[model samples]
Target: MHGYANPARFLRLAKLLTAPLLIGGGLLAVAVLAWALAAAPAERLQGDSVKILFVHVPTAWLAMGGWSAIAIASLSELVWRHPLAGVAARAVALPGAVFAALCLATGSLWGRPAWGTWWVWDGRLTSMLVLLFLYLAYIALADAATRDGQGQSRIPAIFGLVGAVNIPIIHYSVLWWNSLHQPPSITAGKSEMAAPFLIGLMASTLAFSLLFGGVVLARMRAILADTQAEARLRRRAMNAADV
Candidate 1:
């Protein structure tokens, strides 16, 4: 993995792999969306509105998954000093934030019919909201630290590690409080969801995960190119000053 941290190596591999990744991700996304929205059975309670689960649940899952990736990458940057760790961490922030917002928005849309309100201060919802804010804060902190030349990698890396505390809080919120958001209906011990619904949920989860991976890879490549360009510019300026 560290060997691929070299920008040249990464670029070479990315160029080779880009077409396949794009094709696979696109196909999976389309297939999953079709299966989830069109083929899955309507819930006994929520009816067609349950189809929103295909989008909402997957976005929520990816939002957490993205943050976990950031936390792991940040840890690598701090401990292993991996050059690409910071890039990966920063690359994931925007998509994570967008997905977090999507999760909240879709949850609210689903809630209106189910919970009888557009918004609620319930434990799970509030914790998820905090997760969204954490994503925004991480992006803002990273952007500021980079622009001020106050050290780009270390500050945001530390912030990411610290902010990761929210992940557990969000996960356990339903268990710990009397929230409107129901506890996991598809638990290991008791599976309440029908087989078709569960299948759609799993497919959607896979599609979102693939989409997130492709997006992060694309963003990281762009960042590496920009960094290389900046270095070349600085070298040119130095050579001119010497002459």
Candidate 2:
């Protein structure tokens, strides 16, 4: 990982990997979504509403996973002082928030058909909503820190680490409280879904995860380049003043 601390090395790596990730992820996601929509059998209970699973579940996974990335990056910044740690955290915020919003939107759509309501204050939905708010807060705080020229503020990192506590609550909320949301259907070594549904879901998850990775790497490279440009401009100004 430290090998990536060198911005040049990281840029080369990001350049090499980003295209493949985007292309491959795009192809796979399209194929899986097509399959889910056109061929996958409707659930015996939920019927066509089950189709939303392909999109909703993956976005939800990415949403939580995004924060997990932020928390990990924050930890690295705080403990190991990884130079790109803040960059990684910043790269994650917008995309994570987008996915979280998508999760809520899709969940709402799914709920309207399945639960007879468009929104619910149930444990799972409520906690997931809170996760979205957390993402927004992190983005705002981190952006403010950057704009204030206090790039080294530990506030965002601290918040990232602390915000992670909500993750497990979001995961376990369905189990811990009475809710309209369904419990976990797929678990280690067993799945309640049929093979076709599982296959479609797994493919969708992999595709979106790859896309998320590509986006993060690309964002990191952009941030590094911008930072370098600013540093160069600063040095040039100082040199001119001295002359």
Candidate 3:
């Protein structure tokens, strides 16, 4: 991990991985989506409404996963002083927020048919909404810090770490509270879900995870480039002032 602390080396690896991840993820997503739409059998209970699981489940996982990444990176920045950690945290914000939004939208769509409503204030749903707000707040804070030349500030990192508390809450909400949201169909090496739906969900999850990783790397590279360009501009301004 520390070996790639050097930006040049990290950038090289990111360039190599970014394209493959995006391409592979895109192909896998199409395949999985098609399988979900056509091949996966309709659930006896939810019928066609179950189809959205392929999309919604993955988005929900990534939404939490993205924040988890931010939390880990934040820890690295604070404890290990990793140079790229802040970049990682900031880069993931937008994608994480996007997934959170998608999760909510799809959840609503799924619920409309299954739960007979477009929205619910259940524990799981509310916590997930809180996660979305956290992502937005982090993005706004990180962007403001960058614009104000406080990009290296510790505030955002602290927030990232603090916001992680909600992750467990989101996960255990359905279990802890009486909610319309179903209990986890998959658990410690066991699954109550039918085989076909499980298979499709897993495939869709992998594809979305790959897509998330690729986006994060691309965003990291962009953040680095912007920082480098700003540094160059600063040097020129200093030189001009001296003359």
- lDDT at position 224, candidate 3: 99
lDDT string for model 2 (158-191, tens) is: 9999999989999999899999998999988999
Q: Which residue pairs show collisions in model 3?
A: none
Relative to the true structure, how large is the alpha-carbon lDDT of every model?
0.86, 0.92, 0.95
Candidate 1 local distance difference test against the native: 0.86
Indicate whether candidate 2 or candidate 3 has the larger lDDT: 3
Local lDDT at 80 for model 1 = 93
In terms of TM-score, the best-performing candidate is 3
Model 1, 88-145: lDDT tens digits are 8999999999999999999999999999999999888998899899998999888887
Candidate 1 is scored at a TM of 0.94
Off by over 4 Å in 3: none
Better of 2 and 3 by TM-score: 3
Q: Which candidate is the best by lDDT?
A: 3
True lDDT of residue 81, candidate 1: 88
